[model samples]
Target: MSPSQEIELTLTPAQAATGVVIPVTLPSGPQRLRIPPARNGDLVRARVGDTEVLLRIHVSGPPAPAPAGKSGALGCLVALAVAAVVVGLVIANSDDDSTPTASSSPTAASTYTPYTPPTYSPPTYTPPTYDPAPAPPPTTEAAPSPFDTGTCLNGQLPDSTTAQTVRGVKEVSCSADDAHYRVIQRFPGTHDMSRCDANPRTEYGFSYQYTLNGSVINEYVYCLVGIGSYSRA
Candidate 1:
């Protein structure tokens, strides 16, 4: 701002952390700004007073050492003098010891780095906040469909997998959507299927034999009436 321009006082208290909400006044009205916390000696921008101007504020860095008054300086000098006299007396009264080793040493050149204070940028856009823990990740697992273990529920067939042994048939998919075994007929191994075969004949099928192909333990053969084979045509 020009020398004549001045900032109005703010109602917000000083802050030393980020995301502090500062209350400021503008010619338009009073407003709250969420400005990031700044270190001492940093310049922060905020609308102040009854003008359109935004004022640059200097943050106080470290605390300044208290100025030594005249009396304090004199006391410091007297302390230094007393310390020197005591040291001299101690040396005069000390017993002789090994001579100290001396080595030539190089003095390091003093370097000064220019100070660069942090500058505050406008805060980024922040949406409304929600505090609740994120909704528990979806409860379901990538599990085998219920149909994988049994026959179709109602009439909804299970999405096919590589191979599922159901009844006496190891139903296998033949297409993208999958081909399934809808048992058109069932019979005991001891009984003949000659009079119970599907009209078109099942393309592929097997028995539930446990020990051998067609063993008596799983004597039931799940027969398919029709393969349901069809193309886009």
Candidate 2:
């Protein structure tokens, strides 16, 4: 039998959240209870908000009976299902591990052989031909005169008194038809007058050689080429 009188206790903040179950004598047998509002232990689970605060009981009682063969058989069936799942997991992991390792090794390279080109010998060289140049024309210098002579016995060539009586002479001659000859003289005379016969003792003069075209013989037979004092060679 149980007494009807009841007692109540308040909970501290730490004790309330920790689920510290307190068993008190209820004027009957020992009963478990929580602190806040002093609620029944079974009615108020040892939890505060979302947290479950585990609180074990150390009560004196008889041991419960063992499970029957039917319960054991059900447990064995569950254990076999779990074993099958574990084997499947092992096989899946093995496949993943083996496949990646096989593909990781590199493949072999292809073989190659080089081609050879044929050898060539060069042809002999041939040089071009050319003609020789023609020879140059010959060169020659004719000889100078050996005997050329003259003298002014009458002083200078152009005399003031005997200017009208002056005589011309051909002192030289050329052998070739294209060749010709002329004469020149020097004397002590001014530009306006020549002392051709100033004095027979003081007469001093000179003469030079020149040319007249032999091919134009008729046009220049008696032409006076140049005037000078006189000369003996």
Candidate 3:
């Protein structure tokens, strides 16, 4: 094969039933391709362009065993030599006078001290005495109104078209079952109902005007939306 020509080599194992492909390119002169060791029945395939060649692997069996008679005689001679050495050692040890002997006198009993645990005393914990804080003086000022902007109320409007002075409207939680209206926007220092017209969602308008000696002091316009029963008229 030419050096430029490429050969596709495939190896398939008999036990695995799988094929592996390896590319091989031959040199201009003699070249050697090392093939991997395989089982006895494995197959090797080589392809050059369109032509393909398949080869089967053949592995030789193991060598025959040695004769058993010679091995048995050799083992017997080794055992006899070992036995002779053991007998010589036993005779030599029997004549020795330096071996130690056990004493015939009675031994003293070993004394043991009993274990004692250390004494542990629990610490006494004394509760701290604290003087109660004096109760705040009873507040004489009037309670502030709970109704404000963003606060919800559960009440019907006395008049929807004309702005009415808001009073006796206790604020309720927005999630409460009795909540009927929610204050969307509040205009401080002004009681004009037209200010609430900018918000399309405003269904009701209420004003809070406080006067001191015939002069307006504190005023607020609350733009409200009805929850369920009341809607924009």
Candidate 4:
């Protein structure tokens, strides 16, 4: 029996009438109790906590009839023998009623691992670098002049004797009514009037000068002729 287990012993009405005397309850732990002599066929009920068991009493020898005159001594011997038998039977039955405790095996302890959040690294911020578009490569091409050789003019030339610079010249188609002069040739980088003498159709020459801060920086010349019914040759 386990150390903490308890038991209860009881007898039926029939067994009690036969004069059985046994402990009604057994508390936890080791204890001792007495069993009164009982008949061979008496039944005792044992309760171990919630379970119940029935135990049968057995005597080794049959009862002898008591002598008619001297019953006390013979009865005493029989009672002693019966008591021993009852005690033995009670012990045997009690042993059968005991429950064997099963040993508990040790269990493996579980290991707990805490969750760790992943390290967060914000993305590095790099501002965009912008360089002003490289200045357009310095233009090597020169600006185009308003008048080109072979073009017709609509206005008269300025009086070369008094004019220092020519202006107000309007180019037109030779077929128009207001067409006045046609340029036969032109000279760049020089304003010499003699350059027009090489062309037979040249009747007038004009010098154009570009000045900055009252000093001539560059010049051009145009050789022209009155467009009197002139047709392209």
lDDT of 1 at 90: 9
Best by lDDT: 4
Question: How many steric clashes between backbone atoms does each model show?
Answer: 2, 8, 0, 0
Supply candidate 3's per-residue lDDT for 146: 30
In model 2, what is the error at residue 122, expressed in angstroms? 4.6
Comparing candidate 2 with candidate 3, which one achieves the higher lDDT?
Answer: 3
Across 1-233, the per-residue lDDT of candidate 1 in tens digits comes to 22223343322224432224445554545554443433332333332332333333334444333336757677567545533220100011012222221112111111112347799999999899989988756444332221232231121222332224544223554342445445545555433334344535443233444433323343554444333432111
Runs of candidate 4 exceeding 4 Å displacement: 1-146, 158-166, 213-217, 229-233
| Reference-based TM-score, model 4 | 0.32
Task: Put the candidates in TM-score order, highest first.
Answer: 3, 4, 1, 2
Candidate 4 residue pairs that clash: none
> For model 3, how many clashes?
0
**Index of the highest-TM-score prediction:** 3
What lDDT score belongs to each candidate, Candidate 1 first?
A: 0.36, 0.30, 0.51, 0.54
Error of 4 at 12 (Å): 99
Misplaced by over 4 Å in model 2 are 1-111, 117-123, 136-225, 228-233
Query: Cα deviation of 82 in candidate 4 (Å)?
Result: 99
Residue 135 of candidate 1: its Cα lDDT?
Answer: 75
What TM-score should be assigned to candidate 2? Answer: 0.17
**Global lDDT of model 1:** 0.36
